[model samples]
Target: MHIRVYNTTNAFTSLGATFDERVLLGRGPTSSTIHGELRHRVGSLLPQQGNDASYAQLYIYDPASALEVRNCRNQQLRRDVLQTIQDTLLQVNPFVEKFR
Candidate 1:
């Protein structure tokens, strides 16, 4: 399972980074609470902004190696992770391109 969100807001990217760190540091509201023992990656595709681009792409996914050991528990965890990501997106309201 994977997601590629374009034009993501800085808040969303920052939250993702924080979540990953919390998962590592065992502090704060880590998404791992909903999905235990699952390997996932969620971060900005471009850490550095370009000359004219203010937004970035957010990538979220479980690595292929992790997928090899997939089971019912893993499937449920993936679903929960997706739900969490969707909720964050709804709050941040990113990926909305404006047209003039």
Candidate 2:
């Protein structure tokens, strides 16, 4: 999994230097949250935004590692990972809307 945060408001870009190639946003025994290494990464930006910014966008790149059948028999692991991500996002930004 990898993510990128784009701040249309420019407030998030004001943060200091760039982020490392891989910052652990969150992790579980069978899942890991990865993000792109950029001047302003999602991990750093989210804390600064504080769930207030209405224009921030997150681009998630799932490598499908957890979805591999051999790695995740019955697909339960994949579902767990997806649920983890959803729960994490909602927890971080309660204002986020869910459309399924």
Candidate 3:
């Protein structure tokens, strides 16, 4: 699936730029167990501030993949990643704005 967030934070944008695709392999509390594989993409407008955006693409085996993300076996890491995605999305969220 796909998601687009606008007016994201700097940290979010930075994290997005460096976000690792391996996170999709979320192994839960299993410590780097990696359940599956996925990808992500966070972008920005050509203009300036207030026009930044972010996006995340996931490739789960099935809808059940939620099980890995939702009730993750690893609580801390899962919480950290989830929180980062949430907080950042709100910060420098990506969108379809035209930069000048």
Candidate 4:
């Protein structure tokens, strides 16, 4: 998965001494098959920097599934991915709130 930062507020920056304006969420070479496939399909998730705000978006690729799936298998994968994202956000909510 990859999370492209959309914006960060001054309040957020004040909490940290150093901040990366952009962040990559997963640890894999961009040349890897899955990454390549996602890049091809979704284009770029990272917006031009300086568009400061407070939100991020996750973009993931499953080469075996269509972007919009009509079948059971792909639907299951979508559900699982959604669940994972929700769980992750719940786990991170407190840490995120700390910057506020």
Which candidate leads the pack in TM-score?
A: 2
The 10-residue segment with the lowest total lDDT in model 1 = 58-67
Query: How many residue-pair clashes does candidate 3 contain?
Result: 18
What is candidate 4's lDDT per residue for 2-81, written digit by digit as tens? Answer: 23211111012212223332344466554322322221122233435763122221212231232222123223344545
Which 10-residue window in model 2 sums to the lowest lDDT?
3-12
TM-score of 3: 0.21
Query: Which residue runs does candidate 3 get wrong by more than 4 Å?
Result: 1-55, 58-81, 95-100
Give the Å shift of residue 62 in candidate 1: 24
Global Cα lDDT for candidate 1: 0.34
lDDT of 1 by residue, 1-100 (tens): 2332312222223332222334556555535433334433444454455422222332222222222332222343454454554456545554522110
| Pick by lDDT: 1 or 3, better one | 1
**lDDT per prediction?**
0.34, 0.34, 0.33, 0.31
lDDT of 3 by residue, 43-77 (tens): 43232465312222111112234224332433434
Poorest stretch of ten by lDDT in candidate 4? 5-14
